[model samples]
Target: MAAAASPDRAHRLLVVAMDFDFYRQAHSDLTYADIDPAGHYGAAGWREGRDPAPWFSTDAYLEQNPDVAQAGVNPFVHYLRSGYREGRAISRSQFADAYYAALANGDVPITAAERSAAAEHFDARFYQTMNPDLAKVGIDPLDHFLRHGWREGRDPSFEFSVADYLELNPDVSASGVHPFVHYVMTGRHERRPLKLDLTFRQAALGRLQSFEGRLADARRWARPIELTQLGVLAEALANAPARGLHLTFSHDDYSRSVGGSQLCVQREAAEFARLGVNHLHVFPANGWPTVRSGATRTPMGVLLNGETVGSFVPHDITRALKSYHAEGPRSFAIHQMLGHSSRDVVDIVRAAGMNAGYFWLHDMGSLCAGVHLMRNDVESCGAPPPQSAACGVCIYGAARSGQLREHELLFSRLDLTVIAPSQVALDTWREGSDFGAREALVLPHATLVPSDEPPPMRDGPLRIAFPGTPSIHKGWPVFNHLANRFAADPRYEFFHLASKPATGTTARHHHVAVTVDQPLAMRQAMIDLSIDVALVWSLWLETFCFVAYEAAAAGAAVVTSPESGNVAAFAADSGHGLVLRDEQALEALFESGEILQLSRSVRRPGLFDLKFSRLAAELAPA
Candidate 1:
């Protein structure tokens, strides 16, 4: 049992250890309420998990030494009595050593020098805005920074962030000095960097933000594969077909997301079923390759007639391939191979004895691992030579050379035909490399039916919007930047049309969910909002963008960057919108009032049905 001090001695020890300012700041009600902190600690503060000082956490000490808590003794008293002598480990205090050192000796008032330095660097409003709790208190914000704000990792101003400073300079962090004080005193003189370059972080954040919609779909609709039904699925596909089996491979489950490629796959599968062909859509499980523990096997999901039938984790891949092989004539389509093995795909075709294979040019996944050809998840690299310096600097650069080789091997091993959704897409892919495709052709997803509505007449500033999810590759950042620049201007009103609103953006969010069942939702929303322009500033060479079509369908003039592959082509060919060269050109149009004039001359976008089965018979082997 630990040594225990008498009640009188314990009270004396408690008073000695308690930090008045820290206690008052921690419990705002105690400060300025004329209540003695020591008196409160004796009454209820200790029981309420309040720390006695900056150096000592009451709850932490109790948790670390449960015996002290079990005895119902004051933790501060126990610590002062013997716990300190026993060298018991306590929670590492968030405050620096300077705070503990001052608290240990006696009440140390904020030094004049420290206060002046903090005041020079601090923005009281910024600090209070960042920390709303501190704003509610009547305490001087500058005093708070000198005393506790730095300890709490709060930024002193927009220019100076405490966490950023500490992360960049370990010396300051180790010295236990206030970050803003150190920066204003010496960090600036030492030529130390201030704010972190958030370019890469923004790129990563944009990728994650764009993926949110897909994640929601997966959670709501995607189901785990039925592991036990693998054999049954194979047998059913083999026997159910009156003609032959049609196998399609892609990156993820079509049932889990609304994308152009996913919709095409769904349409193709439905058409195959109507033609008396058993269709099996196979993709990597959970949208990525999963390697089992203590084994080299990866799991794959198999969907038949749009329903996931089974999960196959092959311990012996060759043996598993034989189970899926049907004796009848078989044809295959490789829509994407993002999360699957190229060798495995080739093996599957060889094992199933497929006579012909069709490869879809869906965002250049075959050219590079970064499917959108985005270098570092930022700007488009335009499918540059894999050995070029541009590729060397790209995050996907190292994998591009190897991926292209694998894709070539897959194409060489099969009687392959390359199908691009647009002529521009096909030409771009052809320019990138020679894939030894047996045949290459353009097949548009839908044919447009031009609308006959008269040009829209409006009085207020032209309402502009970015259709679909906010993504880096999709040019959400570009749109966001433009919105911020013109936020106060009455020339434009920005809007984001998607299922969810983007964070830290100035655009007014309008919820528009476009699914297989509600394909016209986006178009309808644009019509309702009286949106004059749809900004499709895609950062990559998009294969075929549905947003451009949807915008045109709503009689909104499509404004896009030249990098947007099919969108640019559609705009130029259809005469439904304008294709600006760059951000500067776009800004120039807005400045010159050319955008408003273009809107008045905007041609209506046509509606077209997507029918992959139109070329199905030709794609199949004789």
Candidate 2:
């Protein structure tokens, strides 16, 4: 009698495969009863030729596995107990039925009507081909899929890409719904896109279209985006005595913002003040400067000696300066021009008749709009040649090409002296741009001084940290990767030291707010925490990294990648840390327990304030 199936075994299999709701609804008589569905199915439901679930048919299972019928036993109980492991195939109504049954079980979370709809889109043969292991086992492909295939990134048919769909719709993945079923039953109706992989040309065109759209949106702003006016700007310049004023151009206000570039500008302004030269700062009032759409007016803010002079359109500012031919002597310093029109800058330079202009490489915005040479805001591209395939794929590629052309014209028109914070930054910029500047030189933002005392040894897992905001260009991804890799390992603990905490990373956060007033906050925190290693794995070639210095000051040995620009250079020159070739090597160092050795070599850092010597020399005596 087919070895009379064990009651315990039969009950367990039936409980897992049988959809109680489907069974209760399919058999109306039991819909109002309180009896267990499995008990009722085992007692008399199968005897009356009833199905166990929406997808499993008694007649179909018996027809495929005739031995169960021959034994005069329940087909689903037999199939789940042995037929599944035996690789039996249910070729007829089984595929669609299994697809529906899988959803009816509550794991897929689709409505009965949607489950019915999802089954119609299932291509059995296509699924079999997509999942050869299930097909090779001669098992019901749809059944295996509903139970586990979707979790393994296996697609059900040609209509959907499981991995791409899950990646595109994280909410669906998080909700634990089968991607194909979701796409077929809901995603299509919701107008969700399919086939996310676009060709090179299509991707590039899409990026360009997006960029143009932002530019168009930026142009649509009202005439006066800010509260200030052109009259105030004109009045400020009119009151000027015109005694060789030093005009500085940046993307934003330097006084309020906190950044290496802003600090440099402030320091340079201080030096200019010391030399008795008037320092006038001009920047795009709307953040990033763009070409005005025909008659669309964009405001530019002006600051003189740390106070707001006024805001005016670039055209009016240039005109006002031109009208006053009270030019005594003028030297221009372009701290940054991220949001300012190169043409506007040229107009201002020409109007003021700037005898010499110094363009600081605060970032690679001069080379590409994707400043820091970070491609698509993910990883560094090493300032590849314009129009190269690398640039073509980047959203900022087209804009970079145009910016480079404008820079070339600007360089040709004015005698610009290029100043980079590091030799590597200068070399990278020179390799990517042919601006033909009158001079190019390096003026480091800060110098490192070694302290007499060595770091104290602490008995615990190495405390590795990533300082500053968790930004992609700052190597947050790499740091996060390391944190995830060694999270469970007892030898290491990861930390994020910044003003704010980050999400989706495996690092313990310690809020270290560093501002102009509290510049040593991060260093003090690192010292208090006894941070062993600082991961300064910046993706871009940093002009200068304040974090590396901060780590050194805290007596922490820095672990950095070779492409970290100034961080890597500082580590090698200062002997404050080690520079790794790649992520693999970094992982290996952690794996080998050699990171503990690095902590032993940590030397205290002292500020060697060179104090902008070359910059002071450049701002000729008034």
Candidate 3:
């Protein structure tokens, strides 16, 4: 009889257990069920079923036994008994909470099922406290159950039982433990209880509620696989067998320390060494450049031909003080701020199997399909996901090229094989990339255009010509400076051949003659513009600087930047004309005898042949 009731029920259960007739003897005028009308002793209050609490307090029992209370053992479990009374219906879901809560609170010796459940539920300290019966038999509770198997309902093998094992290793055993109590706990003769543990669905539904579905910000839980909250992770980790998930802080969005947890550093690397996490890759978004309107630096000291010219802090935006940074044609932030999703772009190489070339990547960044721009669904390419095709050079393709640049260049995936037109372009790509460690190649889009048609002879001192749009990149400011300086000199004559007509100050400028020679044919343009020295001055990498080649082929002594890629390199190789360091050097040349000599000697060494084989080779395998 278990101590499962108040004074009245406890006494009644005791009498029934000792002598079923005893309860009837005391109440001979009544039957057993009537004596205890609640049926606590029959089927209501019992270990196999529901049970009632003691009708009275266990204070008197505690008073009689101080040791039981001092030991922190439940007096009801020790003094009275279970299986003596009945109460309301009990459920596993209801009991699981109570069971864990009770285990958390203290130890108890209630029943075999309760003890076994506790053995599987609580930690080592709690188990050692509750299972003294197993310990006295000198059997490890954990090893015994795992090896010999728990009482999950089969024949109980006495040979493998902890008591038998101790008997074999007698030096380890002194058995005074109650055999009948052990048999009840372990189950009838080895037939273990198979259904004590709940089913997966049962356990899942009967689970302790987790911290999921507690919505947070977009940045808080962007990862689809791993959890973000630390406390939840720690809780999950503590009960490793119950749940399959572990915690992680492996997002690229954080490079510096988030809280005290160091990200993208060795501190976290060493910590994750022992953790269950496998991936912690870095994203370009984490270390995105701090793009600003102004330059990162101002001119510390202006110089010409390596000589110190001047230095000053800028008080305002003026011609004398210039921004050291390059300004983009337009802002791309409008899309993000306005929440306009970028369009999609198809990969030209992957689609057509073409070897990427100059502006190939730039073109792929766009959705240009023949004439109309295409749209990116952003579903085809796998991640790190491809950005919208709408991000590109606005001067050329707007979002088509710009978004593609961000997706393919800035934060591009590793799979893309980027190609270049020349060494100059490759150099530029390398300088501007955190990529190139993977797929990068040097292949030029060039052709040999033989110089055959010679230009008609022109009458002038040294007819120097510079042709291009009035752009900062075209060295327009330097050209204008030269025009002003040589305006009064009759010995020097210059032509500013523009891609289009200049309307403002150029028409009336006193020095160089300005004209819009938009000719339908290159040969005709060369013949009409009987220019001598061709100024192919530009500030950009200029891919191949075909302008320099065209001018050179048109029989003009070309003066160009020494660092302007293939054009400068070719000039050096062919001994074409002058490859200078600065604009100041150009001034000296225009005022020198070499200018006249080079002018007369410049010839149209035509070199133009379509080089499509480079593309073919690029598309081929290693």
* lDDT for residue 465 in candidate 2, whole number 0-100: 93
TM-score computed on alpha carbons, candidate 3: 0.34
Write down the worst ten-residue block by lDDT for model 1: 288-297
**What's the candidate order when arranged by decreasing lDDT?**
2, 1, 3
lDDT of 1 by residue, 2-104 (tens): 7677766766777777888778766644544557677778668889888778778788898888888999888887777788789987764444365555456
Poorest stretch of ten by lDDT in candidate 2: 603-612
Report the lDDT tens digits of candidate 3 across residue range 1-622: 2323555565565554333332222221222134452343343333222222323233444455566546644444444453123331212222234334433544223465645643443233323333333343434444333322232111122112444333443333344232223444544346543222332223334442321221123336433332123333223223332211111111122223231112112222222333332211111122111111122222122221112223311121122212212221110000010011111111211221222222222112222210111112111121111233432311222232333344344224224355555665555545533443346666554444564455557656666666656554456656655654464456666666653544311212122221112211332344466666677766544555545655655666677775445667767776666789876687787677556766553453343322222232234222
* lDDT scores in order: 0.72, 0.73, 0.37
Query: What TM-score fits each model?
Result: 0.65, 0.63, 0.34
Please tell me which model should have the higher TM-score, number 2 or number 3: 2
lDDT of 2 by residue, 401-511 (tens): 677776777787788899888888898888988888999988876655555545555667778999988876787877876775566678888899987888645588899
Q: lDDT of model 1 at residue 39?
A: 72
Model 3 poorest 10 in a row by lDDT: 330-339
Q: Give candidates' CA RMSD values in order.
A: 8.8, 17.6, 36.1
Best model per TM-score: 1
Error of 3 at 617 (Å): 11
